[model samples]
Target: MLEDHRMSDISVAVLCREAGVSRTYYYHHFQSYADIIYQENIMSVVQYMRQLPDQGIITTTTMFTRYFELAAQSRDTQLTLVKVGLESSLIHSFESAFEYLVKNDLVVKAHPSRIGKKYWTEFLAGAVVNMAVRWLQTGMGETPAQMGRFVSNFVGLTE
Candidate 1:
């Protein structure tokens, strides 16, 4: 229904009626219909990230390919989330994903216990997200693979 009448005069009331649900129930299932948009967006991101071999190299190339595919599929949703100012948990979600890669030893950190002999993980981690945010803004001239390699190289995280 949202797909059919998203830009039309059809409204929340009409959606509720058409779906055979109360306004409360409709709203309850989602924080307004738009919430479904973002939730789907996040789930897609999570699923794409999940596909990389957990026990193998989750290289910059791999990261780039997956993320790039995700961005292409849901650019609007990603743009909205990135621009909306990330929630702490949202940022943490990225952190956790990287951590998983680290644990699987797929990321090949300079030092698993202490990369480059320092807790440079924070710096390394931030760089990925920072670059991603930049991509969100300008997307500049970089392909997702290129951007991924750039980020991976920056942190010395080799495949």
Candidate 2:
């Protein structure tokens, strides 16, 4: 449905018809089409993160690059979400996932004793989310490797 309709003024009836599911079943599972989109976006990020190996500057760069690649693959769905004003949910999902990874030591980073880990995680997550949104908004002009390098430089990740 998204590939064909692109979420511009899509309705529950149309979605249900496309999926060949009853409206009752669709409503039972999803509150709205936006909810479905949000869950799919979150699931994609979490699944990718889960598959990432260990933690280090290199791993971090790989994760960022892989995430950008994934986003590039689903650019259409993402753009639709942006058009429908659900971009914040997408950003929040990534921010939450990244924060969890940071807190659990899944992503390597040094934390200052003066500031809490949560604060550092939130700061990093916000920066990354903003960069990602800008990248998507601008048609992902940079390759994943370029984006990874830019993020690595911004975060002071060294070899």
Task: Pick the lDDT winner.
Answer: 2
lDDT of 1 by residue, 97-142 (tens): 6666666666655445555445454555466656666676685567
* lDDT (tens digit, per residue) of candidate 2 on 42-131: 888877676676444335677677777767777776776666667776677777777676567666553334124446655666677677
Report the C-alpha displacement of residue 13, candidate 2, in angstroms.
Answer: 2.1
Indicate the residue-level lDDT of 146 in model 2: 83
Give the Å shift of residue 143 in candidate 2: 2.1
TM per candidate comes to 0.59, 0.74
Give the clashing pairs for model 2.
Answer: none
Q: Which parts of model 1 have CA positions greater than 4 angstroms off? A: 1-42, 53-55, 87-90, 113-122
**Residue-level lDDT for 28 in candidate 2:** 94
